[model samples]
Target chain A: MTQTNTIRVLVAKPGLDGHDRGAKVIARALRDAGMEVIYTGLRQTPEQIVEAAIQEDVDAIGLSILSGAHNFLFPKVVELLKKEGADDILVIGGGVIPDEDIPGLKEAGIAEIFTPGTPTSRIVEFIKENVKH
Target chain B: MDLIQSVLNGEKRGIAKMITLIEKNAPEAIEALKQIYQHTGKAAIIGITGPPGSGKSSLVNQLTKKIRSEDKKVGIIAIDPTSPFTGGALLGDRIRMQELALDQGVFIRSMGSRGALGGLSRASYDAAKVLDAAGMDYVIIETVGVGQSEIDIVKLADIVALVLIPGMGDEVQAIKAGVMEIGDVFVVNKADKDGANRVVTEIEMMLDLNTEKDAARPPVIKTIATTGEGIDELNEHIKKYWHQIANSNELAKRRKERIRSELISITEDHILNQILSDKSSKIDSMVKDIYEKKIDPYSAMELLIAPEK
Candidate 1:
């Protein structure tokens, strides 16, 4: 069953990553899945991403980081979300994250990590299943 | 009436509504802006722009913290790319600056480029005006930073910082001529990267070569925005530029130019819309005729512009 309100997502690239093909692909996939997605073009800071999520009243925030700055960037985003009273938002990530770092990311409150090759359907389904209206 | 009053009182919903109205070019929004126009001019607008990978958002986050430390209210309007097919904005930049969301003194808004020719959303101008009228001490307009169109920020900001990063191959050449010319302050962000000094030197050389008699030579500052290094100096430079603009006649002249440009844009849009609406069928027929070579496009245009005989 289709939900009455479309889930809003803020998909962003953090750090100096110039590779945004994945971000663009995901943004398109999410839009195709009947969600409203805001794609911050590239080189966003954690602060800018979170600010956008809150301003757009997005239900989820997805960050794509490939610049090897995930260790520093993800935690900062989680911290900012907590401070902003937006902990309710489902924070997810995708990029060149290693499997070993996934645990630390989860521990830091990132709801999920969808690596490269993860199906867009899975992302849509995960949000549909987890995000509370 | 309530919308106008609420906007003047700085209500968020009211401000949002006014922006929507302005974006649609609604008459009421024009009236509301007229009413609140006198209350503006208090906000110091800073434009953050650079090549796409220049870490502008991170720099903005650092700037936000520095500004907040001074007990000033800040507003940020980040322009994100809109999907060509779906008309949706992927608001990725806002996620980078989430820390300030909880700050009562800070307000952030993200806009979609929405296929606008100028790389900025048409609504961005009105949104900035709304933030200005809402009593923000500082308003930062961050563009997607793709060349020519990104230069629009110069018209909207009191201080424009052009951010650059090392390791972007041929960055000096990649930098748009328009953005290079408009930058009031140059920032070599991600300065911890290799060849950071080289980037700074290159920027300095460029600045030296480009300095004009009438324009102040922009300073190039090295910053590692991620770690907040050199942010204070950057902030100080921004303030100094603001003060310089305030103390001189340049600010007034700039504002006049902005208003003039806005007027021209509005008139153009209005005339185009009116013409399209009034002669939709005729225009379609003319287009079809031109496509079939039944009439030349120039004569069709002449007929369209000529009053009905």
Candidate 2:
């Protein structure tokens, strides 16, 4: 017999961004929504984030970058996950990313980028709907 | 068979997949774990447990680095608690172990206790076996911040290191009965802080009180995990303990006891699953009867068992 499955996600801050309020909020919100979230603390590199994701075997990686490094940081994580053959992990973004950067990020394999003021429920629903595993 | 073969071949992804399946209790997992069990008992299993903010993760990181210096593979199982209400957990142990993630020789997995008591998820036992079958030289299980009774680690780990930091007063009374006896090696981490020596003295006093005069007393070592101080000493102690136990029949005795308990638990789960199966007549209607007080839980359980027994 099988049991109800629990989805695991990784929440990370991949830059010199010191403030982690957004990441903590999403982690807590996901916990409230009944998902396990692995929180990699601040100042993690793209390589570190991706490695944690694979080791955690998470269904998704939620990257929060406020240092304006989404251009370099977010895509770098996605690329690393790909190189490791873990591209199936849903990659999403949040924080102060600009509208102009969202398209480039999507092209780079970020499924969605939630800018400021986006509701936590949207992130939860996006994960619930998009997580393949 | 391919997945089992991959695990035997030491592929990281395969081990990861096996652990995930085990975590979910997938139907294939029991069969897969049964095969994997043949390859276990080779790796050195160490369990570390202490109170919150006791530097367990940092100490584990240091110990891993030290072990890797010898060119051995290490598998880390770090546990955290799950919120009972939401069935969710924020597993932040990896936050202290980020640097070790990229080390191919090091495979670290975080687990939420999933409402398991005694500070570990039940699946951690199978996950440790997966790592062992994959040929890791060392398997380190770090428990969630533990209290007195969270000594279940002793059953799984060949040796248990109970890490304590300075500044928590009344330490002796805190772990007097529960974890105090379970620890094979006591570490006073964050020794740079004040009162480290006092904590050491307190532990020594407690150890001196142990009446097993023939047994080796667990050593109390001081460590600054952030700087990797005293980890070599701790590693040496762990190795020495292994050597001592290896030369005797103690290791086999411990393993036999461990497997016995594991068998009992797994069988109990299987029986319980059958009783709690999705058939509406089984649990759902019984739950309603219990709620309505038409039947008490104990009698309902007897009734449920009556038909089969």
Candidate 3:
């Protein structure tokens, strides 16, 4: 009855941000760390991201946005997941966002935020620790 | 039971959760498969396979849009390779099919091949069944960019379309003998690129070598998957193949063959798993016995398989 446990994470880019290098980096990092990562390439809407997360049945969704629209876009994805009754999917963010935005994003249900120069291992570790089964 | 009911109710969440569990081979999968198997065997499964960097994903996207225009519901299973070192995978096929992600009529799932060498994970076949039981009109599977011997898609799909792109290599290397022999339909994607016509000619030349005179030649269609060129014609060719097979009862024959292979495989897995994992059978002791040469491996297998006999 024992089956292998696989951690599935969706690495996505939301909004007008054309910057996807960060998302790709985290995706490759997560994969190299033994997690199945699905990368939805650039310019995904919150709705599309949520829909994909549901279909993929991923344990966590790491939303990477550098368009300075993180405040609006991050909460929108979290809200849509809640609306779809899939809020159990852990939502996290990473990018070039300023220091003032972390607390607000965290309050909006984002589990954590990784800013510039953070090692990819920390993000991978955070996903493994926070996945809700 | 509730998940089964929800899946039957066409709930996406339910279907997705069930597919994940079935892929993992959880205990509940057996009962669920029993309930769902009867609901399957109706949807057409089409496999789009080809070499790396080819336009298989884009073709799937366009074909899906074409099917959706007819008001048919579609389910897509796109498989990608897992890294051997980390047992992890990056399923990026969805990036090319982004337009279909939010469409209510389409359900797209990306799967990691999970060490299966035949271009598909075992979970992918089960996921296709989940989609079929959930009432999809067509299920489309896109295999990881394939090479020779990844032709496993041919055994499961009702129709197999082998896609090739120009400028990859000489025709001999590009047209792998293992895959070239099985395609029901052929595609020259990126037809707008240079050397497109040469690729077409090479396939035509290859097809002419077949000695099966009664079999109609599979059509070779040219396509530029990015700009949606020649997709309508490709879809028509696929439909024509389906119609021809259905009229000849070849569809039933293929399904019967598929079932025969699948049943044997499932039974083999079950017996081998039980034999190796059963502690009460003294599997560990048998290992020690073989190591000490007290029993040969073949005798050990016979003893494990039928102790009383």
Maximum-TM-score candidate: 3
- Model 2 interface DockQ: 0.76
lDDT of 2 by residue, A62-133 (tens): 999899988988888888888999999999999998898889999999999999899999999999999987
Per-residue lDDT tens digits of candidate 3, residues B96-180?
Answer: 9999998999999999999889888888878988999999988999999887778889767999999999987787864557877
- State the TM-score for model 3: 0.97
Task: Give stretches of model 2 more than 4 Å off.
Answer: B171-175, B278-303, B306-309
lDDT per residue for candidate 1 within B150-236, as digits (tens), equals: 578867888889888888666556344766777789899988899999888877777767646788988889999989999999999
Candidate 3: regions farther than 4 A off = B174-176, B279-283
Cα RMSD to native, each candidate? 7.9, 2.2, 1.6
Estimate, for each residue in A46-130, the C-alpha lDDT of model 3 and write its tens digit: 9999999999999999988888999999999999999999999999998989999899999999999999899999998999999
In Å, residue B62's CA in model 1 sits off its true spot by: 0.9
RMSD of 3: 1.6
For candidate 1, give the DockQ: 0.16
- 10 residues in a row with least lDDT, candidate 3 chain B: B274-283
Chain B TM-score of all predictions, in order? 0.92, 0.93, 0.95
What ranges in model 1 sit over 4 Å off? A1-28, A33-54, A57-133, B23-28, B171-176, B292-294
Candidate that would win on DockQ? 3
